[model samples]
Target: MNTLLKIREFDAHGGPSNVKMGGDGHAQTSTTVGRFVIKSIEKHVSYGKYAAWSGIAWGTDIRIDGGVVMVKFNGSWKKLTDVNAQWGKYKNDQKGVADAVLKYQRTLYPDSPIPTKWLFNDFGHVSVKYFKDINKDRKMNGKEYIMGDFIHTTPTDEAATASRKIFQLAESHGCIHVKPNDIDTMIGNGYLKKGNTIEVHPYTKKAIDASHKRDTAKLPFEVHFYPGIYKIAIYKSI
Candidate 1:
């Protein structure tokens, strides 16, 4: 019953440059996902304002039972020590650009599970959803919007310690926070289930110039940290 599931999103208004967060708080914006689908997979509940600021707003607050799945948008909570101090300062001041972003996240996830820190706030063990729902009535300036309208992706409240020095990552008020074993290996290798069809947008200047020519033809060591201090002194003289 191919309900249509060609999901291929790659947003980066502020996040997703392979996650090292610092600017794109609230999981950044811009979402459409063609027409949205994935109706349900429930059990990791905690809707709206993260269940009124962690007040137990529902059942199963997240432990991966059924591993949350209610796509519509309304989930986000960042602060796992500020995403491990921004990838632990890029693995302590860029250890070869954090080992080439962990070798491009293990060559784009080669069987998942490599997260020691940077869990984007742990996400209650993981399996959140949401990458669509354009604007199902969750009005903005029109008044009548209280983190509702759908854009969720639960899990990641790891007991909310609440620190703030300018921290503002929590904003799944349009959910997309994932990690629970990489959504259980994309729903056990099925590429996500429940009437699939996700496609969130943003990043199209010819897909950012073909992702800068596939990260410079295969992460030339994270493209030598993208030319800054003379390309980090020519990547420390090769």
Candidate 2:
């Protein structure tokens, strides 16, 4: 059995659409988009809060605002106690750090690409990292180490501090943020697993139109397998 994870993202300015998952050509389950965000800062320089990447190249960098790529679930899921717990461990507090970084960005470059308001909380409960390179070869040479991470979304204290409301249009630096309950349901059924491919799609008219046009032919993120394992695909609509 082959599993496909199809994600169709709607326009970032609007609400999230539906996400579908299944094996073969059949649909298993669908979920509504609670809330998600994309990269607001677009630059190549590394800011303390925001990871730096070349804006020239779309998918080659960390900013995945409007792009598509296939990545595998790197490992198992780990449930964190709370947003504070994640901040203490990973030191990825977007609010505090991004604010300081944005201040510095303003001083260094008055016309900085960094957004005015930034707010991001940990996935809340369970989270997983996805990567393009399974092996550590690229990492050893100092190449793109981790592709991106996925986390279950839950309302938290950290989320409240930001000027923007959580789950509305709250943007991420690059990571894929999802609703906690939705992911919990999927994990409960053992649908998501190590080595499962996650296809990230941008919520753009061009990409959506192209996908619709190529509905019949083999699509960009469509997967094929010999058999035995379950194939899951997540399609997100705008």
Candidate 3:
């Protein structure tokens, strides 16, 4: 029984290129008026015939499962190959196959190619992992706490304009908490009949100025005059 083996004619760093297999011997049988030519195969042939001439107990009928077969190198399997005939329609495309291979290589063989997937099974350990736990402190001072409800609701553009106008009037007067009805009449131009809550603050002026600066002065510079309505609150600032 001939011992057939698959031998890589290509180097470990390279692929199968212009290389040939070893061993040979030819035969020529004579008949009545003709001759037949034959060749004796060896134990190892080119990578091209790896799956074709497997000499297992099943003779040369030994079959190799189709797909990328991992080839060994220095006690480890790091690379794969497939028979051209069996490669089917998977020869080439733009599906990032080579990129996937390179990614695998970097994962499994971070340091040296000598230690491949078989040796470095835990590829994840070689990579860097980062985690962060953030804790935020939500605390406000007397002024911010008291003025928090001043413009509490999301207002439409027109309502926001009214809110800003009313806030500006109160800020210019330098007082906090005006009569809700008075503010309604003053800023709402008598449109606001129901009295709710109103507050004025110098800090609001600063906030408005900062916001206006941030918007490159596209926003109104003065304090908000007819600020939008807010839920009533009894809070007061020092």
The number of the candidate with the highest TM-score is 2
lDDT per residue (tens digit) for residues 19-92 in model 1: 23234234433222233434444343343333322222222222211221111123554221123333234433
Off by over 4 Å in 3: 1-89, 93-96, 113-238
Candidate 1 lDDT score at position 96: 48
Query: In candidate 2, how many Å is residue 105 off?
Result: 30
lDDT of 2 by residue, 1-238 (tens): 2222345322122112333333323232222221112111121222233222111112121111122111111232111112123223434444554454355435434453453322222333445444444342322223433333343342332233222334532333333344444445555543344433334433432223222222222223331110111122343222
TM-scores of all models?
Answer: 0.21, 0.32, 0.14
Flag the better candidate by lDDT, 1 or 3: 1
Give the lDDT of residue 230 in candidate 1. Answer: 11
Clashes of 1: 19
For all candidates in order, the CA lDDT equals: 0.30, 0.31, 0.22
Q: Which candidate is the best by lDDT?
A: 2
Which residue runs of candidate 1 sit more than 4 Å off their true CA positions? Answer: 1-27, 30-34, 39-124, 128-170, 176-193, 196-238
Q: What lDDT tens digits, residue by residue, belong to model 3 across residues 1-238? A: 1121211111001111122332322221111111111111112222332222111111111111233333343344422323233222344531343344344444434443221222211111111111111111112223222210122111121222434434321211111223323333333432111221111222112221112112111111112222123111121111
lDDT of 3: 0.22
Angstrom error of the Cα, residue 110, model 1: value is: 34
The clash numbers for all candidates, in the given order, read 19, 22, 14
